[model samples]
Target: MTLLDNLLFSLSTTLPILLWLAGGHALKRTNRLSDAFIHDANRLVFTWCLPTLLFLNTARSSIVDSWQGDLIGYAAIFTLASIIVLWLITPLFTTDRSRRGVFVQGAYRGNMGIIGLAMVVNAFGTEVIPLASLYLAFITLIYNLAAIVVLQAGQTRLSPLKLVSQLFRNPLIIGVLLGLLWSITGWDLPGLANSTLQGLADLTLPVALICVGASLQFQSLRNNRYLVMIASGFKLIVIPVLAVGIAYLLGFRAEALGILFLMMASPTAAASFVMARAMTPWGELAAEIIVVTTFFSLLTTTLGLFMLRSLGWV
Candidate 1:
């Protein structure tokens, strides 16, 4: 396909999600969704719905057979590189220690569970879900590790044992682990159970998107207007370009390269705002970053996909 064709396709896949976000925003403006309901929905999405989706997708995919050692190693390296870069930059530019972690997480904590899977399915189809799932499992764990460290830094003492315990206990991580192990056992879920899992999984993305939209605080946008631009630039533009360049050097191509780029380029996670609100006073800035990047990705993602396709990479 031509570059224009690629851009159109990318926008088609991305626009539906954006509309959901817009729908949520409109709902809140009309008082159809109260803040209390939005908060509860966010919690539900993070805790139960997301894990169910991850587990169901990973369970159905041939994760063991499609497992790529390079995929894991590159994902780890990319995630660490992102964390280190964002962290180092945080101290130089920001004076508020409280907001530093939020900024760092904003730049690196991607909305993979939403945008990543959508991009993968649009470009490659369900056959590629296993690769994305495997990569998601590793990258997400690293994201949590980095978030905890940065958010807790220069403040309370961290217990290594506690951190380790939390990592393993993370519902998303747990789901991925169980899904992979269950896939290995080669025991299919009963038809009824599979359909039930699928039903729950289907709820995750739409609800997550709406929750994200409803949670956005415009006050945060006004407060951190410039910072939002900076974070959006880095999150949707700079990091993806740099990370994808590295992937190219490593000989990743086509869907693997495209999916990796999606992992890098997608908007900041909506959940980051949830954590930022719960952890520090920086939730406002995190929320602002999410809003900016989510909108920015609509344009950048299309362009990025066109460029990748032109390079014969995706």
Candidate 2:
């Protein structure tokens, strides 16, 4: 597909997510959903809906043909490199040690599960689905580690190992591991099991988007506008450029390169805010980062896609 075609297609698929966010705002304004309701919806989507989607997709994937170890390796390397760059640049944006965690978390964590998957599927095809799943797996693993380190940087009371353990305990991570195991073993889920999973998975994207929209606190954005903008720049500009450069250096090209670039260009993950609220004091900051980055990602992603196409990467 041409760059413009890819951009338009991406925007088409993304419209649903943005619309869902808008719907949430309308619902809240109309008193159809209380703030508590939105909070519960967020928890449900993260802990249940999203995990189900990951598990179903991974379980149904063809292990022999779908497993892309090299792609996973590249994704992991790119994510790690991004985290390091964000860490290095953290001091430039903030001097408050407590807020540093929020800054770094917003800068590096990406919405790989939702935005990345949607973009890859739109630009590529179903064949890229398995690759996206693998990419998500690697990104989730790396993000958890980076999040813990950022969240606990100055907290002497929190052990890194303990934080790591807590991250693994997350249902989404468990689902990923289980799905990988099932795929590797070539086990078919029973009809009942598949139905249950599919049902739960169906709720993942839309509900998550709605909750994300409703959870957006305008107050947070007003309070931390500069930090939000910095986070957006890191997510949309810095990361994509770094990922493309790294992919080129590693001899990656064509669709693989394009996919990696889009993945890196995605906005801050919704899970980052959830994790922050559950484990740290920077959750609101993370939410602001997500909102600002997501809004700007439309432009940055289009520009990245155009550049990738011009360079014959897609």
Candidate 3:
């Protein structure tokens, strides 16, 4: 595909997400979605809908068939590295402990399951979906665990036992674990159960995006604009460049390399805002970063893809 094609593809995947966000904002402006509604909706998305989505994705994928240890390993390592780097450096951006955690989470978490998978399939075709699915499954777990750690650390330190308990108790973590178990055991859900899960899974993205839109406060953006830029810079530019560059050096190429770049380059996960709002007082910071990176990722993702394609790296 030409650079123009890639650019258009990137825009196509992200534009609707932006529109969903805008739709929510419009509802808020018109008094259609109130604060209470948004809050309750976010809780619903995070607690049940998102977990169901995760469970279904992982359960449906044949992890054994699509297993790529090196690819998954690189993704997990770089994800943890990005989190550590951001956790250490985010204090430079703000002294507010909660805001620091939100920054770190925003800077590192990508919307891999949604935007990342869409671009991956478009670039490489359905042949790569299983690999992509496995990647999503493993990385989803990492993102949730790391997000909880950093977000909680911002509030106060906890014992290792307490942290582990917190992580396992999380619905997202449980969803991923149960899904992986189902995948491994080759258990098939009955038709009715499958349909029910599918219905809830389908609700995750749209609801999450709308909640993100409604929660976006101009005052928060105005107050935290600088921090938003910093988080966006890491998420959309620095992290992708560094992660993909390292993968190229490490001898990854073609679809493997392409997937790495696209996943890292996608944008901040909308779930970041939900998790933030649920756990911390800094959901606004997470929402701002998501909005900013998501908007600019259209250009950033295309340019990155074009460069890799031009250089014959992917």
Candidate 4:
């Protein structure tokens, strides 16, 4: 694809996200969406829609056939490593304990399920869906567990046993586990069941994004601009450059290398704000990071892809 092609692809993937975000913000500003409604909607997405989305994506892939062991390994290890790096470095930027967790989570998490998958399919076509789905399953599991740990550590001390217990009870983790079981057993969801699950899964992103928008407050964002930029920079630029550079050196090439870059470069997940709100008091900071990274990733992703194309790396 040409540079223009790259630009259009970036726009296509991110534009709808911005539009939905704008709609939510407009509703909130105009009093069309109330605080109580946003709260309930967030609870609904976090508890049900997001998990169903995970299950459907994971269950639909035949992991045995679609598995890319090296690709999946790289994605998982890099995600954990990024979280650790952020955890260590975040303290230098802020002394606020609550904001520390929110900042670190925002910096490392990506919208891989939605934005990353779209970019991969557009770049490599439908043949990759199975592999991408499997990748999403593993990485998302890591993202949720890691987010909880960090956020909890930032807020208060907890025993490892208790944390493990809580993690297992999490709806997102349960969904991924069930999906993996289905994939392993090679069971097909009966037609009606599959359609119903898909319908519920489809609501995840839109509702999550709208809730993110409604939660956003301009005053909070402006006040936290410095931290917001730092998180956005890591999400869109630093993490991708470092991770993709290492992947290239480690012999990833063509489609594998491209997927790595796109996933790494994808903006902060909309779910970050939901997760923050549900788990901590710093959801506003997470919302700011999401909005900023979602906007700037258009430029960073396009330029990075163009450069990789020119270098014949992908």
Report every candidate's CA lDDT: 0.78, 0.76, 0.92, 0.92
What is candidate 3's lDDT per residue for 1-314, written digit by digit as tens?
99889988988999999999999888998899889999899999989999999999899899879999999999999999889888888778898886788899999899999999999999999999999999999999999999999999999899999999999999999999999999999888889999999999899889999888888899889999999998899999999999999998999999999999999998999989989999998887888899999999999999999999999998
Clashes of 1: 0
- Model 4: lDDT equals 0.92
Worst 10 residues of 1 by lDDT: 149-158
Worst 10 residues of 4 by lDDT: 91-100
lDDT of 3 at 39: 89
Clashes in candidate 2: how many? Answer: 0
Model 3 scores worst on lDDT over the 10 consecutive residues at 90-99
TM-score of each: 0.88, 0.89, 0.98, 0.99
* Model 2 bad stretches (over 4 Å): 152-156
lDDT of 3: 0.92
* Residue pairs in collision within model 2: none
Clashing residue pairs for model 3 = none
**Candidate 1 local distance difference test against the native:** 0.78
Per-residue alpha-carbon lDDT of candidate 2 for residues 187-267, written as tens digits (9 for 90 to 100): 789999899888988887667666666666788779888888888888889878977887788888877887888888888
Predicted candidate 4 versus true structure: per-residue lDDT over 1-314, tens digit per residue: 99999999999999999999988999999999999999999999989999999999999899999999999999899989989999999989999987888999899999999999999999999999998899888999999899889988899889999999988998888999999999999988999999999999999988988989888999999899999999998999999999889999999999999988988899999888988999998888998899999999999999999999899999
Point out where model 3 deviates above 4 Å: none
For residue 271, model 3's alpha carbon misses the true position, in angstroms, by 0.8
Model 1: per-residue Cα lDDT over 1-314, one tens digit each: 66676667667766787788788878988999987887787677667876787677667666567788887788788789878888887777678777788888898889887777777777788887778877876677678667767887734666988766766776667777777787778788899988988888787777877876776678767878877787788889888998899889988888888888877888888768766765777666886787778777878887888788877787
